[model samples]
Target: MASRWMWASQTIILLGAVFVLAGCEEQTNSAQETESAAVVSTPSVLASAGPVKTAEPQTPSMEQLVERYKGLELIDAHNHDASDSRYQSQLGLWKQTGLGRTVLFGDVSEPSAVGTDAVAWEAYLKYPDRVIPYFSGFDLHDPGCLQVIRGNLEKGYFGLGEIAVASTNSPVVSKVAWKANDPMDGYLPQIYDLIAEYNAPILIHLDPVGGEPLAKLEQALEEHPDTIFIFGHINAYNSPQETERLMAKHPNLYGDFFAGFTLYNPDGGGKAEPFLPVLKKYADRFMLSTDSGYGITEVRAIEAMYRVLDQLGDPVVQKNIAHDNLMKLLQAQPATQTQLKELRKQGAGGAGTEAAPQKLSKLEAGRLLAQAPKG
Candidate 1:
């Protein structure tokens, strides 16, 4: 009887040990599965976004950069400020920021035109050298608009537009905005002819981008080869290569470098790789601006537009884009110090503008830029 009891106890102990080992194996497998699931769920930062921009890690504050661009004087190729009061308010900012002059225009794409065209003229009269005026009509096709434009030119307006060729205006606004139409259609042909006659540049705004709009713009460029066209916002928002291609094909085309898009990384590192080549190749074709990226003052606009060029650090290239090229377009040569002094006194009608180009030293030019406010 004693021997049978001992054998039974030994068998129970062996069975218990097997069950204990199995439970430990199951627990180990469960722990591993939990860890594997956690590993699969997490994501790296770049997983969602294809490739990150390798821009400069550090950037300069806007004010710290003011003197770095020692002699950059800007001719803002495009801007819209319907408020005539801005002319008085923003004047000092313009002077301090080295913005020598700017081109102001009324935008026709808005619901309320509110005599913006007239206001631009008024702004020019108040600060003639600081503000170059452009005439904007509700419809370029309007029969009497020709007389209005001619009158503006006589009043010393510089050009015509912020003209909306194709517009997709504010959908949320209760009223319908300016209708988007074919740029080459309507009375634009006659109007363009008149613009050429006056020797004024025309700034056209075409929208909904790509497809037919670009085609029509190209047609306008082809048809009116005599007229100088500022392709506002450059190749209408595509690769800089497209802007370069258009510029290469058309001698009369000029581009405004605004749009908050750049081939530059502001950190003093990372080249706006595609940008430098085109800018160097067609140095004379583009001018610096902040079209509707209007700072509180003209100088603010100049600084904002020039931030990229400042990072790039080529003073010669900066001079051509900011001053000399636009001077060529305006049919005005760079002024001498004595000439610059005289220019400050005279308005847009001054005769001194046609004088020979003088190489302005950085210190002298920077001083003159702030002081000489001629258009």
Candidate 2:
């Protein structure tokens, strides 16, 4: 993790990058109005997977939102390692913040990175279904790298990434950037082939901030369309329009809307409205995340994200960004998405009524915290 202490800090007033333009962002809300309505009217696919049960959309309780979406599983597509200080409280923190899952990665250049990977692995082992691990990019032939990769695959590591190639001040990022610029660097093309075979997505951090240097990233995307590539924050270094252009052109390029609105919005969360149209238009191509790490847990990011969801305000769109898109990345399947749509149309009477992720009881949390590795 970066040296900055406030990884996803709850206390920091997250005013995203200060470079936001002052002019009115183009609003395309109406462009997708017909498409949205069509989706709603599509007679949800009710199937052989038991009768569907969905509840009416009343006031949006955490549970109401869950049931309405049918077994809603909120996923944070980007996360760094938990700080040693926060290790014990991480799960509790997630519970409080309504985060069901977090895709975890770390800086690859650090020797200690493997330790962080171990920490993430422990969390994955403790909460198999909720924690998905993605390793940093490395030479496939490196015995050490492959050993860890193969071991984690057996233990359920999800994919490779949050890896990036951007010229940056951070030493770790610079190293990754170097690897990215070299065609033969770490023999990535061959590795990407293996990843494609495994059916796993790779999270990439391309631009240091603004991805002005899209040439490298674009090349990789065009070359490996079969390899799922998750670009960093949708709102970072690139305007929403640019992000949309990339998504529209490349079917394999995905983005995580990593709560940039929280810091960048003039009023905080509502800043996301301008991008909602694009988000809905390419619903399956995006996922929501806190991108919280270092010392910060996801508490603030998750809250800010839900606030955006509330303002954006379409249930199906919300579910897609929240979890459905991620499930596809996770399992390479959409059975959950289809089932969710059917149940949403049916009105979840009891299906997935549990609003938030099931939490560890107080005692359980305390016990785990006590036993949490102090690294």
Candidate 3:
């Protein structure tokens, strides 16, 4: 009986050991399967994925900028296309770029080229609404220049300009040297007096760097407060503080803020930010321009002008600087009819002369000139 009981116990114990070993083997196989699955899945997922991406900021486009600025009713207060060949193209540019008006003048750099005044007249005649014509052809030194100016003003020229009185540094700009012994020297007072009588603006390019030029400018401003002097490029190198002081001192002394000179001049060595305070402070006393001289394209220069509007940021101020300020001067009293009749009788028909100068259209002349090789 004892032997039978012991055999039963041994069989039960062997059965229990077999069950435990089978369970261990199944767990080990499950773990191996899991390990194999991870090894295959990890690389497959990584291989399917590409380089990680990150979000980046964007800048406003030129088109977007144009759209924003198009509503400002901009006036180009100082612009020159001395060669009449580009009048049509200029009109188109002004239209496309949203320029409401332009103060147009001829090149005064060369003696012979001064007849470009005819070009200015032609443009004014063709698009009088768009152009505010200014006579700049006569020599400033000529004592007879006052009469010539009177003759043109009598014939209905808007103002005088781009009269480079102190341009001496730049070789390209100083092609024909023009310096004032001082701003008030020579026949300037007479010219100023005539301009005052006509109640028109005279755009002067006086580089008042030294004490004398500025002092003389102040003297002129004090002497003829009625003569509206639109200082071109705001005397290019003058500081904002100086500009503010001058503006405060002389209400008749306005500024032509040449955007290209401020923003694109390689030698300017400054940014637009510095001038903002003075610009905003004297918003009504300032007007924006695209001098169009700095080897910059018209479109680019116009863009710079718009940029000044954006920087100014106040709609009313922008409107004043862009259009109304200059318009006020433009809409002011012009030469009297009495003055006109006498001047006309003196053969001072000016732009209204019988034989208007001949001119080639841009498509005909400009393209060929552009295609000609550079010197």
Best by TM-score: 3
Model 1, 214-256: lDDT tens digits are 7777788889888888766663245667777878988888877
Models 1 onward score TM values of: 0.65, 0.65, 0.71
Assess candidate 1 and give its lDDT.
0.54
Residue 102 in model 1: shift from native, Å? Answer: 1.4
Which segments of candidate 1 are over 4 A away from where they belong? 1-60, 109-114, 168-180, 259-272, 294-301, 332-375
Model 2 lDDT tens row, 1-375 = 452211232343333222211223343443234223433333221111111123234424433333444345678787774434233345544543456777776555344555666776666645555567676635433546555554554444677765554445344455542235432245566666666755677776554444444765677778987888787676654466787888898999888786644343333333565677788889888888777632232444565566556656777888888888887666552122323333345444123413421231212222233333444
Residue 355's lDDT within candidate 2 is: 40
Residue-by-residue lDDT tens digits, candidate 3, 236-309: 67688888888888998899987766655554433677888898898888998877544444555676677667
Q: Kindly give the number of clashing pairs for every candidate.
A: 2, 18, 0
Which whole-number lDDT from 0 to 100 does residue 262 have in model 3?
61
Query: Every model's Cα RMSD, please?
Result: 24.8, 16.4, 30.1
Off by over 4 Å in 2: 3-71, 83-87, 137-151, 169-172, 175-179, 182-184, 208-212, 261-270, 293-297, 333-375
The lDDT values for all models are 0.54, 0.54, 0.62
**In model 3, where do residues sit more than 4 Å from their true spots?**
1-59, 172-179, 338-375
